[model samples]
Target chain A: MSVASQDTTIRTGRVTRALIYLTLLLFALFYLMPLFVMVVNSLKPLHEITSGNMMALPEVWTIEPWRKAWSEAQIGVQATGLKPYFWNSIKMVVPAVFLSTMLGALNGYVLTKWRFRGDTILFGLMLFACFIPFQIVLIPMARVLGIFGLAGTTWGLVLVHLVYGIGFTTLYFRNYYAAFPTELVRAAQIDGAGFFQIFWRILLPSSGPIIVVSVIWQFTNIWNDFLFGASFADFSSQPMTVALNNLVQSSHGVKEYNVHFAAAILAALPTLLVYIVAGRYFVRGLMAGSVKG
Target chain B: MGFLDIDNTTKSYGPVEVLHEIDITVEEGEFLVLVGPSGCGKSTLLNMIAGLEEITSGEIRIKDQVMNGVHPSKRNIAMVFQSYALYPNMTVGQNITFGLEMHGVPKAERDKAMNDVAQLLQIEQLLDRKPGQLSGGQRQRVAMGRALVRNPDVFLFDEPLSNLDAKLRVDMRTEIKKLHHNLGTTIVYVTHDQIEAMTLSTRIAVMNGGYVQQLGTPKEIYDTPSNLFVATFMGSPSMNLIPVKLRVDGEAVVAETESSEGDTLSLSVPNPSARLKSYNGQTVTMGVRPEALTDAEGADHRSTHIEKVLNKVTVTEPAGSDTFVTTTIGGAECVARMRADTEATPEEVTEFAFNMEKAVFFDPKSEDRIV
Candidate 1:
């Protein structure tokens, strides 16, 4: 009887439905306001952006700001734009994301299926690492990079992000793999598969959702990182976030508001593109391991 | 040595022992079932045989080869897990042939083996389909196919049918039995279901609290259960343990109990076991199966003695095929398996034809059968 009564409560009348959608649309536009400002202002010339209303459509559209932002704008006393630093961010983010996700996966597999004594404690310490302030590790991380002769290099940034990103990636993959059936691993063991074989053939293939979650998470975190970038990276190997900061702060006379806006949009593009492509999976992946199959 | 020998095996976790010393030898082509309640260590024993869990003590040998410290794959054993554990990413064909591929079998040989297993399991149509695309029964078949493809010396089944619907469980049970019959493989099956243990295994090891309570054939376990737990645990609705006063009636021992009508109902114990003589004058339990306590028309005519007692009926459940009549005997609720048209109803005093020949005595103190 209660179930039958729940059927009517599940549905809304036309007016209620329209009101709900209208409220949702209003919230959507409210959140999209910053992107709207950036896009509109970025397409206008410097004079128009300086003189005209920020949210108003450009009277004379121009791509000069974008072109300058891509190639000719002064970033940290260099007129090399955000292009070189963009590639640096890509180089750092890709390997960092790939290495961290893979290492996290291997750590997750070992922690869950091939358990040893004090493994929980080890996992607890790793989880504790996730909560540690990134600022606290910066000094030690810089020293370690110095010892390894990788300080001020793009690879140093890669190593820094990889180490920092491991905790979160392991947390994601571990939780996801924890819900995975141990019987399958045992079955694979009985089927004559070795450690890496079982991981590659059985575990990795089924880890689609969690992998997306890890990649997207690592990509965004590494790309958008400002603290680590500013603290470690030199002028040559500075990532996009640090370069974007220099681009915004370096101009002495004219503000170059359009150029700053254009550079800012470029700095935020990859993460935005990643979210646009795999955002749905991010939510689904987070929900997957929280509830058991 | 038998095909598979579990010789005095014990399993422990630090200070706690989960499975006591268990010893059972299984012949080649024999089906042995370990049936018990949850937390009874039945699955632990099966895992020991499969080399899944390390043995705490004693030896598990397959075909005279000591299996301690042996890898699971090298032990020539394949297990069907409770969840079926089909690799979700692999197609039916790849899933079945995984073991062969891992063992470095040639691709052509692995493909042939996979095809043979798929054909044997009648899953030829689902070859290209992933495990996620298959239904529960189909996944079960694929699990079996994976095991069957290996054609190992011993097959271990860990509650494999438990994940299916009741109807499908029964169907798969029959099919597994048929497959065993045709293949003549040495299978060590583990289930908490006594009916599955009864219907499938050539022999059964009824376990409780990490102990093998009784090990025997189905009829031996059913008719002559070694202890009180085995007597009650192996049957549906279980055996009724009626508290009765034992008294020597001339040459025979008689079990006397207070009926539902508040009258004395006496049942004779013919040809009592020699050890049962010591139980005279003491209050003991009389274990009787539901079928043994029936109406006049429902009684087994072959039995020489059918003690008649008029007891008050408490409940009558008409279950299509057999009507189960509930009545009180010896201060315990007893159920009698009656015919579909059984005349007994609640509140009415009906005559029960008790088959004393099927009754067994249990000592109240030890909780073991008075054998």
Candidate 2:
């Protein structure tokens, strides 16, 4: 309200604006630095890459390594390479993401809203699944899949991903739906919305951020899984993650560092794209269930 | 015939009984309010009528049809919850029409119903917005609109305005009363607010501890409460209760309180009823409201001549319109409503007058009204 205060307020506002821009610029560089290093390393020859100064920009850039990674690295469908492996990853991860998220939403809706005999016990089991070490069950799961004739097939990895993904997905949705008003469910019941109808019409449409979080979590988990894919998938049906590991592990005498980096980038791109697209909803879902009216 | 009848309804969750032998009949156009404090089984009773909660033992009939075990939607009753419960993702229009849409109402008819309700509630501008975008009053209107669009046989509201701000609560309270007046539909409303119960109901059922303490017209319940709980619960700045022994005069019963200075002042009860005959020479509680006590010399002639009762005003609170004087009498503090002109300070002895006609008596043993 005073002239001196007005001058100080304007000066402080200017400084705050500059600070915000500086913070945003630093954030951008933090996210971009790794991708920039990967791109530069993929373009350089082997000698320059191993020169121990990994941070420097390439003196000479060439597309030959990209071409070699595509052709000699054997990442194409035409020659049983990374191309078929990528398609195999998609085939397994898509169904796993879809089925796991659907089942998680269903499980969460029932655990929080419905009062059956053993619902609390079922919720305890779901929470228990989240804490148990996956390595302990790996052999048992492998044997079960083998008995079902699902081992060495895309369905095998899909089933495995679903089994692991459902625990976290259901936890995410159960907490999110807990903050919802119980009266909404009761109102729907009074309005003739039976179990599934209440889920689809009343609960699902309101579950925007939670659904995004479930999809992103399941997709990333299934896409990046090396142990399950390598253990269950055979040579013809293996995902790109297994193929990338084989290329790195099976090389003899000389290591193709450029091809390895490119393959690693390929395996990671799907998950990175998903995070970029739905990161806001994932964070929003984390904050959704902490408050109630 | 009654629109809805509840016959000897009892509810319990295992060994914890919530409601005991609740019998109520709702006429076709009555606005009945079930009023009580929290944990008094009002909401549980409302849920039973709506078929959302199972009645432990009872028969509920709506329009001559048994409603026990009926699905909530099949019972033809719509409830507006205290939380509003508007679907957060749906527009107000969609929320109002959700029940209708579920019952297979055509889109055209649904649209018309939505328009009519929006117009009725004066919320036409908010129809396209979700519940999160609206104010508390607007969301409350949308909730009411949802129930209104159903055109069901009965309406149940469970403390629907308790969540709003005080000013908004009063505004919506009038709006709900007007809606009930216009609809001529059977409505069973629940609230802990005695003011809302007093102003809005055709009849009120006061409950406490799984039992109906009293059920009658609002005026009847206010003038003659059935028990001590009803007397204290129905009034703001509640009635003052004083323990005293009754002495029999020639043709009347006189209540005598032991004075602090070792003396006794006997106040005569003019019309002694038969209930007072058994209570003579026995300890009982005499209830007097604040408004019934005043300065002995005050201009209100009706209260001036009852009998001179002297007590020390211990605390004084002047709330602009009236002054509340707290005084100790017979080892209990009794609050009296005095005019602002009375010059009474703390711990000062003052002569206060009482209107014995308005005083109620309750048996101390049972806590029930003597008559």
Candidate 3:
């Protein structure tokens, strides 16, 4: 069946359709080429990657590079794998994503539903954090982390990401909850639902789309963050990104390209997997807040 | 003490006063409706009663207890919001029982209450459905069920049927009136609709510009409005106010106005009060309802005095049940209701009967009734 139906306003000719699909395919292939190179070379021996074409398939297929990449990354006198750093990233991300999203939902509910004087000004101040450059806050964040003695711990990274993630998460949730009927909150109030109960039962239950948007956003940002990980974390607790950087920097004179490729993909895998699973919801969630009732 | 007493209550947003010293006592089983045009502080007063809004000054009492700092749920009040405001996540049964559940009612008790309210609202089959899945009318029932399940001391309805279609609104209006009749619950209903006020309210507080213009039974508000605003705001086509000079003769008082054809039409005033002496030779407003000024045959049979006058019809609008004949009387546009097959055409001279017994006069300066 033709997609350009009788009611479609902008009808395209067959030639135009062919040209459009060709352009889309070219862009898709262009974007996928790096991922393609990494996967193909990571399967081959290191010599084959250095001497062979990036576009060529691997002839000497071995899983040794994947295994070494998974368990062997040199960081500060220890021959530790990416595994501990991977755990560090997970430890940082889970708490940061969950806490930031929950706190954001609460902030949104209070700002929109239980309004007080100067609330708009307060909201504007909260939003100012979202636009503040990350580099500007690093010194102060480091000082605060040092004062709290969380300077090089996984929790320190969690705190940093949580503090930064709150602004964007609150923006998403506040705008989403603004469209939520205040009448519902008032009705729940009359129904004797207290502040926390109203948030847990009424507003949060209907906050599925915005929550997905927040979780994906916070997860990707906290997982892939390099500067925060490098600055705040110690050698023992550095996240995957920092460990990957160290591994590449300390490649022992001769380059181990296959292990590097596999390590790079390993560092990037979680976020990519997250996008594949929830990519549609991210797009849908963006639209839902702006348009859906 | 009354069931609900709003004594000297006022609400102001910062410096701007929205409700001014509103004092009204609602007895048990009284369906008191606060009706007005938009932004008239009706809903604000309702909210104040519900403790959803703080009373800027003075006191509100429910069951003889001051409710100034009380939380809404503690006030033993339930509200049906304009949007229905059902918890979208909950089923109809849960929606109805959420209040009871929050009050720490047991599971069995909550279930029983929900079932009872569902049957009462005739929404038993909709128990498992979410609010979004229900139709607007069904959602309205669920909202009412939520309110009714609480069985609070007072039921506050903030334009609950405003979202329904016209047909459903009328049906719901009847159902609400029936429910009030059966339950005899003290209700505070707020609406912009005068028809709903007339149909459902045992007593209505006609409000405008943050003031209650009149508070009385529907018949009293309709027949003897206390001011010009109440006269115009309470009726569908609204009461006609014509500028007329009062003539005080020996024993007869007459409302003096000139007809469209340059003929002086003198209509007699009924029950001429001692106040008529003060309004003599003064241009006052003659407030008469459209139904009071009709074709002679359609005039009220019990009306003691039906004064006849000739006026040129400006327009004849043929409504299905009746015709509204518009004409210039005393240099002001006035509507006269007549039979559906009203022969009065535009630009034609028509003889109209004015029910002098139903006539009221307002001092045009202060705009208050002069009786």
True contacts kept of each: 0.90, 0.76, 0.86
Error (Å) of candidate 3 at residue A275 is 1.2
Task: Give the candidate number with the greatest DockQ.
Answer: 3
| lDDT tens per residue, model 1, A85-154 | 9998898889999999999999999998999999999998888878889899999999999999999998
Model 3 residue runs over 4 Å out of place are A1-8, A73-76
Q: Residue-wise lDDT of candidate 2 within B31-69, one digit each (tens)?
A: 899999999999999999988889899889999899999
Higher-lDDT candidate among 2 and 3? 3
DockQ of 1: 0.83
Cα error, residue A288 of model 2, in Å, equals: 2.7
Q: Candidate 3 has what TM-score?
A: 0.96
Clashes (backbone N, CA, C under 3 Å), per candidate, total: 0, 2, 1
CA lDDT of each prediction against the hidden true structure: 0.92, 0.85, 0.91
lDDT, model 1, position B102 = 92
Order of models, best TM-score first: 3, 1, 2
Best by TM-score: 3
Check candidate 1 and list the clashing pairs. none
RMSD of candidate 1 to the truth, in angstroms, is 2.7
> Model 3: how far is A152 from its true place, Å?
1.8
Candidate 2 DockQ vs. native: 0.70
After superposition, the stretches of candidate 2 with alpha carbons farther than 4 Å from their true spots are: A1-37, A45-56, A75-80, A252-254, A289-293, B258-263, B296-305, B340-345
